[model samples]
Target: MAGVGLMVLLLTGCGTLQRGVDMARGAVFGPKGVRPAPEEVAASPYAQLLIEDDAVSAVMLLGNDDDGRTAWFTDQHVVFLCEGDLVCGTHGLSARLDDMRIVGPNPFVDLRAIGQAPFTVDRRYDWHDGYRYGVQVTGTVRRVGEEEVEILERKRTLVRYEEQLSGGVDGKNIYWIDPATGQLRKSRQLVAPGHYAEIEILKPYRRRVQ
Candidate 1:
């Protein structure tokens, strides 16, 4: 059964935006809770992705996967793409601001501001069979001292934040962010149930001279 499920996923890729939104609404909202506005649930992050930013383009390494996946970011979300796929079919996974417990800016989170405050995280997973899973977890961030990390072949010192999640799933995710920009430098985040991915920001995408 597990093998069959894996095969289906590889063959069909991820689910559609409508399916994902439907699942999110049903799973995230209770009888008394209000449904999210349509604009708030739109899946297309392309407009934001088009903004020219030096730090928007990145590379993410899947858990123990040798192939590196290309990551694109907007002010509100980050989308990971499958290599060599068609433009419309490149989306492998995505994370949005509405799903994140940000402290400062939309995507840029302030580690110091988070301190020991508890926050809620809602992550939506789009599966191959047109199914989506909304996982809600309560988490807290704490400063874990500083560490020297290499980015784009340059070593830099960064503060480490340990994000501990409970409620839906119990796990400890690590994040290293630039204090100056509050942008994530490296992260080991939970992408799905029982699955985690290691992500490191590579050099930003440079547009070729036309």
Candidate 2:
């Protein structure tokens, strides 16, 4: 009886010792060369918008929400991610910027260069409810002087510009542009009739390193 008890105790101790050795080995080498398969990356349109040397990527929070969404922009266009699953591209706004004659040390826009008379722009966007519609706005640009604005928690003095729009929608839009590079720092854009969104630049334009 005594010999059997001694044998059981020795076997139990050996079992515990083997468990400890296995745990130590796992910590050191993690299962002896077994590695997890790499996860497959999903393709995204927002990612495609970011092209080397062609566009810059940015992030902005929509409306008063806390969720951040990705955006990509070039000198000619800006694309935004809507609700994490939708992509909204606005080309009309970019066209307006391209049409303006920005000059001088202040890099101010000459509204007259947009044309002596008001011009109309039509934009189409798909709504969350699975419906597409056109928003028409007629507007002319004007300089609104320098103003202090906060972007990404940093205060910046930027040249302010205003667009007075009418037609299908009637509203005034504002933009704060960096005079040094003609980059838009902040904007309150009229998205739809009776609807608007405020956009603040969280990051400046920079080339992505491959």
Candidate 3:
């Protein structure tokens, strides 16, 4: 009887030890071997808009609503022009990013230089102290009515962190493109939701400059 009890205890302990070994192996090998497939940028029109330039002049209207207060604005004036006389009220209000072009590399990469590309994919990879991370960002071209513009979205993942906290953000941006000129069109980031923020691109590239 004493011998049987000792054997049972030994088996149980061995099973627990094996489980611990499996978990440790998974933690070391799983994330290091996993890499997300690269996204294809050529399939989208927005990608093409990032590399071109437009030379036109036009009026752009920008509208924003926060906590019930709405504002309409344009690059011409920083102060949001009151749409209605009643302290601030506007119906069917919209704005645009005006007179811009795709020039060189994607503008979102560096603010100083005008860069052009058909489409843009921005990604970030980081690893430190047993932690790994990955982030995917993209921008492309879009057309609204007669306006030619670009749009963008960003996504991120914490693959190696303690808890999986994956999130995404959607944004509205516009790039005014020119047909034949190499000059840069105006660029504007509208409002929308991303990383716990509410934003929208009321209007983008509406006006044409002469």
Q: RMSD, each candidate, Å?
A: 16.5, 22.8, 25.4
Per-residue lDDT tens digits of candidate 2, residues 1-210? Answer: 343343234323323212222221222111322222212112211222111111222222121111323333332233343322122433223212111111222212222233234433333333332233344445556676789986434578897878776764578767677766666656766554455545554433332335
Taken over the whole model, the C-alpha lDDT of each candidate is 0.41, 0.39, 0.25
Over the stretch 13-112, how does candidate 1's per-residue lDDT look in tens digits? 3332222222222222112212233353244322111211122232211111113233332212234433211011122333222122222232123555
Please, what are the lDDT tens digits per residue for candidate 3 over residues 39-123?
4222321211111112222221223333222232222221122111011111111321211122334333222233332334332
What TM-score, to 2 decimals, does candidate 3 have?
Answer: 0.21
Which stretch of 10 consecutive residues in model 3 shows the poorest summed lDDT? 156-165
Please report the candidate that would top TM-score against the real structure. 1
* Highest lDDT model number: 1
lDDT of 2 at 37: 24
Tell me each candidate's TM-score: 0.45, 0.42, 0.21
How close to the true structure is residue 20 of candidate 1, measured as C-alpha lDDT?
26
- Model 2 TM: 0.42
Sorted by lDDT, highest first, which candidate order results?
1, 2, 3
